[model samples]
Target: MREPVRLEISVAGHAGHVFASREGDGGSVPASGPAVVLIHGIGVSHRYLRRLHRLLAGSVDTYSIDLPGFGATPRPANTLSIAAHARYILSAMEQLGVPEFVLVGHSMGTQFATEAALQAPPGRISNLVLMGPVVDPKRGTVAQQALALGRDCLLHESPSSNALVFTDYLRCGPVWYLKNLRLMMEYPMEQKITGVRAPVLVVRGANDPVADADWSRRLAGLAGRGQLQQVQGTGHVVQHNRALEVRDGILAFAGLGAAAGGEPLPGNPT
Candidate 1:
């Protein structure tokens, strides 16, 4: 039987009364396994990482949160830059009293994870796993790219779109979205990629049209200690369609053994 989803409330910086949810072996990082926190793409929430959580739950503690405005959380008034989102996640980690852990981010959340790792003093973040990272905005025109980033980061599109992922910034409304888009456009992700001290694993779907395999390789090449992993027969949501593979890759990256059902990453190491 499928487990019922559980919701929880927590306070976040500037954004009061933020919402976060979990569906795993309660919040306990294994003594040997590293803690893993899953951050979703621009339009989804912890739900995006649910399948991945289930695969790894048996070996390591996993937590997934709705960014400020997206899930059950209300939008915040603070400037919602990539840095701010990282800080919010960090604040949540502080509340949980987790001193160090691995960060697994999808799509836009990859930028937030990278920013978080850069901000923290060396070694605070053990490793970073980025799935379908958006290093370059492929929306044709510059303005189109800006608009897409803004919409993805701020505006609530349809109910079908996961509002929780972009909720906090949405709470700030259109102006906030525009500001965030401008910031996202200006932030030099490639410039900062090499400075990340933690080892990183960039995974992408073999068929991911948005973040194609070539882009994934480039992303892996940017980190100080980085490598690429591919999920076969999957798209951008690697966790959902290829949960077992994703789980095993993360485990191998963390020095944990192979997850029960799949082989670990099998490419030439970077």
Candidate 2:
């Protein structure tokens, strides 16, 4: 597949970039359907999501964004809150002229994505996907999260995924990452999910140590219209390792085809 076209987006006074592509669209076609906007966690950039982005683009328009202060985007003068990030994200999507789209966020990106869904106008954000969401309240702290992530990286993640993460972290640098670490750890993801009006899909990897099964299920239950789907044999970066499965679940969530099999949540709609 060809590399996605980078679109430099100016949102207010802030600048960010998004890699836009779709099957045969050649970066020229206007997004026609509910597009998929992939948002990465802190430190990492759109590179990790490229494979999954292409896979999803085969059936729907896809845009993987590099948030301000991450990826190629320059660091902001000050650390922005999740709400601020969400606002910029919405503005960028509007600038792109995406009529309606799904918000897919990994790790702490879930915090930003959930905030965006809450801030967006009804119908503008068609759906929300939280993949390996983070800062589980039970273990919400720098040390706790770091230990879990370290264990996950050392024991479970594939070699390629770890390499991608290491390079991205290097690009992010420790100072910029630490600056925002406290905010991510403090964000109440569970409470935020309850405010999202759009359908929420909480996806977790069966082997993920960070967003464990219990936390994922609770997050699903918290949403007004939430569902949980765990991709087997994959870890935190499930989208990269099991792109097809994640695509199926997302497409199904977006009402494009048959329902994807997911872990049952007693209160959440299938």
Candidate 3:
């Protein structure tokens, strides 16, 4: 596997980080095959998405980004809106010379992805993969989301997953987490998804209490070209425990097939 190159970039005065890896020889991927960009959820960094990035990097260039204020990146001077976060991502992509790519987002990352898609030029994004998207309108309040997340973690998450998540939360700190959590809750995901030009795939863990099956399906249906998939026996952080499944789903949606060879990526279930 290719080792990812870490990057520190400035976008509109805010700094962000990216871990970039590529398929095969590190040559530029053709326009026909768009590179993949991964956006992680709030209060967490690229650590949760590292497995998925490694898997996808075998067939396509992959970028896992740490939006400003999360991960190792410092918080901006002021709280940024969802649109501002999207702009920051777009700026980073521009700096990387990625004219077009697939945007894959998880949880609150989905909101950022959607906003980015809306802001990008018509054909910049080929596909949008939203895994365990958040803030279901019916249960849009912070209390409801907290209750759902707590329930899911207690019932479905593994010990390692909990450890990683909470540790990242500690690094992110309560103030930052709550600030962004409010932004996540206030954003209207269902309505914003309708504006996305790319085909949409909404993925969920079967036991993800935060983004339940019904909400996932609804979010997908709202998009112009949307679909949904559920990974069995996982919770909200599906990409961590079920990385292979999530990777295959993304490849299939992006029309990349199983992998370079016509076989499932190693470590993936046959």
Candidate 4:
């Protein structure tokens, strides 16, 4: 039998209340261990990470928050940039009394996570795990850039149209969603990814349509503690179809698997 998940809602800054949840309300966190801060990619909400969270429950104290404009939370009054997103999550963590954590970012969230880890107080971010991370905008092919631009324009310029196109994101509404989209586009990720100090696990689906193998390799090379892993037969949403693979990699990297407390990461665990 599975434990019934519990909800813990808290208002964050002027952004609105974040509906965070977990299984146990007890004193002890969990066996998987350290508090984890999960960040989702563009267009999706915390719902996208549901499977990854469940798979990791036994080993980590997991927390997933809807980015300012995404999920169920309202957007903030100020512009939402990579820095702003990072700051907000940090503040949320501070309020929760979570001193340190492992960051798990998917797609666009990976870009924000990189910026966040760079700014995190020393010792605050223990590790970073990026799934389908974004490539340098300039490095993206013309077609890729065009797609990214089209997506951004839709989210920022046409709220009604965007809502219709990305009904999932629109659930959060346009005002904040548009603002958040603008901020994500303006972030200078290329320069920042290199400054991150935490160990980074750059993961991707073998068949990911967006962040392809080449893109993942390049981003991995640019991160703080970068390494690459390709989940076979999976697409951009590797966490969705290959939850076990993703969780296993994270456990090994975070040193949660049986072995030395913090052993070096081994190649493909399959």
- Top of the candidates by TM-score: 2
**1-270: candidate 2 lDDT, tens digit per residue:** 677899888776777898988657677665577889999998999988988998887777889999888998978898888899999899988887887999999998998999999999999999999999987988887888888899889888899999998999999999999988878988988777877889889999999999999999999998888889999998999988898899999999888664588764544333
Which residue pairs clash in candidate 1?
Answer: 68-168, 69-167, 69-168, 70-163, 70-164, 70-165, 70-167, 71-164
Residue 93 in candidate 4, Cα distance off native in Å: 1.1
| Model 3 lDDT tens row, 77-114 | 78889999899888888888788899999999999999
Residue pairs with backbone atoms closer than 3 Å in model 3 (clashes): none
Question: What would the TM-scores of all predictions be?
Answer: 0.75, 0.96, 0.92, 0.77
Q: What ordering of candidates by lDDT runs from best to worst?
A: 2, 3, 4, 1
lDDT of 1: 0.65
TM-score, candidate number 3: 0.92
What tens-digit string does per-residue lDDT give for candidate 4 at 6-94? 33334445462333344466422332336777888776776767777767766667777676666666555666667677787777767
> What clash count does candidate 1 reach?
8
Between candidates 1 and 4, name the one with more favorable lDDT: 4
Among the numbered candidates, top lDDT falls to 2
> Who is ahead in TM-score, 1 or 3?
3
**Stretches > 4 Å off in candidate 4:** 1-12, 16-33, 138-166, 173-178, 258-270
Task: Please count the clashing residue pairs in each candidate, in the order shown.
Answer: 8, 0, 0, 6
